[model samples]
Structure formats: structure tokens, C-alpha cells
Target chain A: MTRFAFTVEFDGRPFMGWQRQAHGPSVQQAIEDAIASVTSEAVAVHAAGRTDAGVHGIAMRAHADIAKEIAPFRLMEALNARLRPDPVAILACEAVADDWHARFSCTGRSYVYRIVNRRAPLTWENGLAWRVIQPLDAAAMHGAAQVLVGLHDFTTFRSVHCQSASPVKTLDRLSVEREGDRVSIHAAARSFLHHQVRSMVGCLAMVGMGRWSADDLRAALEARDRAALALNAPPDGLYFVRATYPGES
Target chain B: MTRFAFTVEFDGRPFMGWQRQAHGPSVQQAIEDAIASVTSEAVAVHAAGRTDAGVHGIAMRAHADIAKEIAPFRLMEALNARLRPDPVAILACEAVADDWHARFSCTGRSYVYRIVNRRAPLTWENGLAWRVIQPLDAAAMHGAAQVLVGLHDFTTFRSVHCQSASPVKTLDRLSVEREGDRVSIHAAARSFLHHQVRSMVGCLAMVGMGRWSADDLRAALEARDRAALALNAPPDGLYFVRATYPGES
Candidate 1:
């Protein structure tokens, strides 16, 4: 069987996150269904990361094994045609070694949180971004985010449902910037605990609003208790930007 | 009655167009319904220009006269609350003189057409941008766009349903810009005949694809016959960007 690595992009409004679920439609199921339609085999697609509902994926890395002899470009085209009417697309596909795994072999992950810093209700960006009526001091948020950019116990910022055995993870980058009226937060790490990015962003937004200080953010991180979390940002503004593998740009 | 002018924004995917229709939903109807729900009046709202179905508006200028004495802020808030679940928003609102008309008093209009020059199907930007599979020469398109800037009889680009008194109009600007994979065509003029922007964009795209040349585009324009037009771009990529008025920045 030839293993194919696919770069997937999807709108998270309709799917129940990235993984397959019995209760509702998921991005994984949609891609697997499309692959099945193409190969007639019940193939399971694996993703680099699992996103929450309403979270967008710009270049999510995924893989599936198929015995059918189809070119990567043709497979991408065929999958795109089958995924039609659904807000999902197979951006790129390439043959990979059978040993390559989408999730286990991933080395780094990046995410961005978009905030429309305006009081006016969203129109075209309704579900794509989070609307914040209060003006945000992006500089302050950026300064405060620096404290979370090293190895630490992120238990307070992790999800209650997170399955990671240890909340200790090394965060590579956390920066906030504002352009025009939109504030964006960028985070990168080797691996992120469930809801870690969103939780950190929520506390940083508090800092931006002058409700919490950088000291508070540091104190919360030291607490190591989920109850110490100031807030958990909604899934609407989150986006999976990229997944990097070894020796790849 | 007090005249309140609004800067509206909406995703045109759900609407038939900007104007009220006997059948299908319209942005005008959605705003009107919200206003009636707020003030209990069947008020008539006028827009700077009417867009075709699936054409978006970023800061569309419109106005309505209401007998109720309500602050612009309150009116905007009410309308937003009432227009909820619909992909429309009141970005700005202000009191205008009774003499000001959204359509007649507008001095200039701006439109932008977005083309995603890629083979991958759109995900988050579905219904928001037009995707072109062929590689486009944006610089060539931009060079060719300058020829249509001067005053000319644009009969070749005017729609059959256009009700303008004359086809002769001066195009102040028609510039094509490309940032990465997105090619944007910006057009500005005092007024435009129906389908003028889309038709011009369609022909420009043909020029960009090397199917047509700058000379061909000029020949079609000089022919002054609608039959000579190369193509008509779909409404999906068209956006009513802004409406300029006298004494406005």
C-alpha cells in the first residue's frame, strides 16, 4: 500500500472539529468518505492535530494509505471533486514512505487567533473571527505573552478533556500584533496541549483589556490548576496554520 | 422625519441582490425588515448602487428616513441585534441632511474584484472569491487595464438590462494589483453601467491568461457592441467597496 500525505484546508463551521465523530460530521470523515468514493476502501485519514469545533485549518497535514495506483495530483483533484458542497479541499498530495505518520512524525505546529477589534458586528467575517467590542492594547498583550514562551507547566491553560499525560510543554513562540482594527495572536510549539493556545490567548486578551497584568499571567501559569485559568477563548477565532515535519521548510 | 445614513456591510451569498425583488431575499429587504422591527415603520431605504446577486459590500452607503427620534448609535445597535443570524451588519451610522441621497448625491463609486489564482478549491473563502486555475499574468492585465481609464462609450461592456441614459462614461481608475496568489482589480468611477465592472474584469482576465491581448481589449471597447465583449466575470468576485460623496474624506 502506498501512503499519501495530503495538505488539507477546511472551514470549521460545519464540521465537528478534525477527528471522526459518530454524533456529528467531521473533517476526517469527510476526507475519508471522499477517499472511499475514489478507492472504494474504508480508509482512515489521520491528521497532525485535532481542532475544536468552529476552528479553521489552513494547511492541516494528513495522511492515508491506499492500494489504488493513482497519481498524487489526480488523487487531489478527485478528492476535491468529491469533497464538493463541503467546505474542505485537498490542497496538495504526494506519495510518502509507508513509515511516515501524519500525527506521530510531526515536529512542530503553529496556530493563529484572529480578533476583530471592533464594536460593530461582523459581516463577511462573522464566523471566521472573534469580535471584541473593547479596544485591545496589542502591545501589552504582546509583552505579556513573552512570559509564556518557554518551558513550563501549562496545566492551568490546558483543557479539562486533554489526554496528555503531562502538562509540561515547551512553547517556542507567542506574539500578538495589531493591524488596522484586527488583533492577531501567533503561537508555535513542538506540541501543544489541548486548549493550551486558546487558554493562553484568553488570559492575554485580559491583559490587553487592562483587566489582568503580566504578573497575573505568570501567577496563573505557576498555579498549575485549571481553576486558575482566567478564561478560555472560544474556538471561533482559532486556526491551525501549519504542521512542520523533519527536514521540511 | 430625520434622515439617517448608514455604512452597511454584508455577504451577498444569501441575497438576490441589493435591491428588493418580488422573489428571493435581498440585502435591502433584510435591512428594511430590521428597521421596521426597530421603529414600526415600513421605511424605504435607498442605496448608493444596486449589486447583483452574490456581490459583497464592504462599506456600502445607504440611507433611510424614520419618524422616530432615535440616536444613530442606538439605531445601529438595535438594527444589529435584530439582523442577527443574517450575514449583514451596520458598520457605521450617522445623521444626514434631508437633501442627501444615497444614489443621486454619490460622487464616486469603487469596486474590487478578487481572483484566487490557484488550482486548489477554496475552503474558508468559498462564495467570497472567484478561483481561476490557469496561471495569470497580473502585470500584463494591469498594463492593459490603463487603456479603459479614459472617457469612452462602453456599450461593449454594458449589460443588456442596464438603464443608464448613455453608455459614455469616464472611468477614473482601473488598476489591477496582485499580492501573492490573489489578484485584485480595483475600479473607480462617478458611475458605472450595469455589469460594467464584471464585464471589464472578465475581459482583463482573458488578457491575463494570454487568450486575448491589450489590442484585442481595446478593439472590443472601440467596437462599442456588447457582442464583442470577451466574457462577463461572475458576481462572486465583485465587491461594492466604497461610495464617495462631496466633502467626504
Candidate 2:
């Protein structure tokens, strides 16, 4: 069996999430079904991160093992052809070492949350961004986001449904910036608890709207309690941007 | 009667264009109905530009005369409330002079065509942007675009159905830019013939894809015939960006 690493892009609006569910469709299920159609094997697909419903992926990394002989280009074209009618695309496919794991071998992950700071109702970007009618102070939000950087117990920012073993994780970076009427929050870490990025973005938005002070954010982190969380942002604006591996440049 | 100038935003995917149509819904009809619902008067709405079907608008300037005594804020809020279920919004509304006109008083108009230069299928920006799988040379397109940025009889770019009396119109600016995987074409003029912007964008795209040269573009313009047009871009990626008035900053 040969292991193939795939760079996938998808619109998360139609699926339940990345993981397979008994009730609804998923990104994983879509890809697995496509692979089965291509190779006639029901192989499991693993992703660098399992994004939630309504979230988006730019270059999400994944891996699957196949027994059939197939070129990377041919496999990518076939998979994309099979994944049609679904809002998913395989950006790239490459052969990797059989032992290389998509999740375990990942050294870093990055996410971005988009917010349109305008009173105008979203037209093109309806479910692609969070709309905040009130003006946002991006500079202030950036200043306050620094409080969440570095190693910390992120229990306040983690989801109650999160199945992680521990809440202590090292946050490499959290930055906020404004471009035109859009404010983007970018987060990078070795790994993250479920809903951590969205949770932090929600509180940062509160800070941007002058509803919370930077001290309030620091205090919330100190509380280390879910109840202390200010807000949990909707899944619409969140995107899994990229994942970094050890040897890949 | 108070002349209210509105800054409107809309997703044009659901309409038969900006004008009122006999057989289909339109942005104008939707807004007009909303205004009539609020004022109990069938007021006619006029726009700076009559954008074609599937063409989005960002801060599109429009005006309507209302005889009812209503505050600008209240009217805007009511209109927004009534425009629900449609991807349209009144971004801003303000009272203007009696003689102020949306179309005749407009001194400048600007449009943007978005092209996603990527191999992957678009998810979030599915119908909002044109996807070109081939690599585009934005710099070349920009260089060629300069050839059309002056006084000329733009018959080659104008549509056969254009109702303008004369084809001789001065184009203020035409620029092509690339940001990551997205290529944007910005066109500005005092006014434009029907399909002028789309026609120019299509030819420029051909230049970007290395199918045509700068000399070929100049020759097409000099030909001054609609038959000389290479392509007419679809309305999906076209957006009526802004309108400039004489005194507005």
C-alpha cells in the first residue's frame, strides 16, 4: 500500500463536519466515497484537523492509503471528478512515506476567522464571514489578542464537547488586522482544542466593539473556566488555512 | 417630497438585473416594493448604473423620491426589515436635493471584475468570482489595459444592444491587479456602453493567458467594430463598485 498526502479544499456549508456522523454527511465521508469509486477500496481518510460544520478549508491536509497503482496527478483528477456536485476539491496529491501520519506528523496548524465590519447585509459573503454592524477597533483587538498568545490552560476557550485529553496547549500566535471593511483574526499553534479559535475570536470581537477590556480577556484566561468565556463565535467565518509538516518547506 | 439617496448592496444571483423586469424579479423591484410597503406609495427608484443579471453591487448609488414624512434612519431600517429573504441591503440613506438624480448627476462610475486564478473549484466564492485555471499574467494584462484608458470610440467594446447615443466616451482608468490567487480588473469612466466593461475584461483575460499581445489589443480597439471583440465576460464576476458625484469626497 502506498500513502498519498492530499491537499484538500472544501466549502463546509453542506456537511455536518469533517468527521463521519450517523446523521449527516461529512468531508471525510465525501472523500472516502470518492476514493472508493476511484480505487474500489473502502479506505479510511485522515485529516490534519477535523473542522466543524459551516467552517471552510483552504489547503487542508489529509492522507489515505491505496493498493491500486495510480499516478498522483491521475488520482487527483479522478478524485476531483468523483467529488463533483459536492463543494470539495483536491488541490494537490503526492506520494508520502507509509508511516507519515496526517495528524501525528503535523508540527503546526493555522486558522483564520473573517469579520465584515459594516452595516451592509452580506451579499456575496453571506455565510463566509461574520457580519458586525458596529464598527470594530482592529488595533485594540490586536493588542488584546496578545494576551492569549503563548502556553496557557485554554479551558475557557475550549468547547464543552471537546474530546481532548488536556486543555493545556501552546498557542504560537494570535494576530488581528483590518483590511478595508474586513477584519481577519489569524491563529497558529502546534495543535488546538476544539472550538478554541472560534471562542477566542468571539471574545476578541467583543473587545473590538468595546464591550470587553483587554484586562477582561486576561482575567477570563485566568479563570480557566468555560463559564468565563464571553462568546463562542459562529462557525461560518472560521477556516482551516494550512498545516505544517516537519520536513516540508 | 424628499429625494433620498441610498447606498445599496446586493447579490445579483437571484435577480434579472438591476432594472424592473416583466417576467422576473429585480433589485429595483425588490427595493421599490420595500419602499412602497413602508410609505404606501409606488415610488420609482433610479440607479447610477443598470447592472446586468448576476452582477453584484457594493455601495451602488441610487435615489427615490418619497412623499411620506419619514426619517432617513427609520426608512432605511424599515426597508432593510422588509427586504428580508432577498440578498439586498440599504447600506446608507440620506436626504438629497430635489434636483439630484441617480443616473444623470453621476460624474464617474467604477466596476471590478474578480478572477480567481487557481486550479481548485471555488467554494465560498463560487458564483462571486470567475475562476481561471490557467496561470494569468496580471502584469501583462495591466500593461495592455493601459491602451484603452483614454478618449476613444469604444465600438469594439460596446454591446449591440447598447442604447447610448454615441460610442465616443472617455475612459478614466482601467487597471489589472493580482493578489495571491485572485486577479482583479478595475474600470472607471464617466459612463460606459452596455457590456463595455465585460468586453474589455474578456479581452484583457485573453492577454493575461498569453493568447493575445498588447498590439493585438490596440488593433482591436482601432478596429472600432463589435466583431473585433474577442470575448464578453460573464456577469458572475462583475460588481458595480462605486459611483462618484461632483461634490462627494
Worst 10 residues of 2 chain A by lDDT: A118-127
Best by DockQ: 1
Report per-candidate TM-score of chain A alone: 0.99, 0.99
Residue pairs clashing, model 2: none
Candidate 2 retains true contacts at a fraction of: 0.62
Per-candidate TM equals: 0.97, 0.98
RMSD of each: 1.4, 1.3
lDDT of 2 by residue, B106-194 (tens): 99999999999987776767778898888999999999999999999999999999999999999999999999988999999999999
Instruction: List per-prediction Cα lDDT, in the order shown.
Output: 0.95, 0.94
Candidate 2 lDDT by residue in tens digits, A1-249? 899999999998898999999999999999999999999999999999999989999999999999999999999999988998899999999999998999999999999999999876777678889998889999999999999999999999999999999999999999999999999999999999999999999999999999999999999999999999999999989999999998899
The two-chain DockQ for each candidate, comma-separated, is 0.76, 0.66
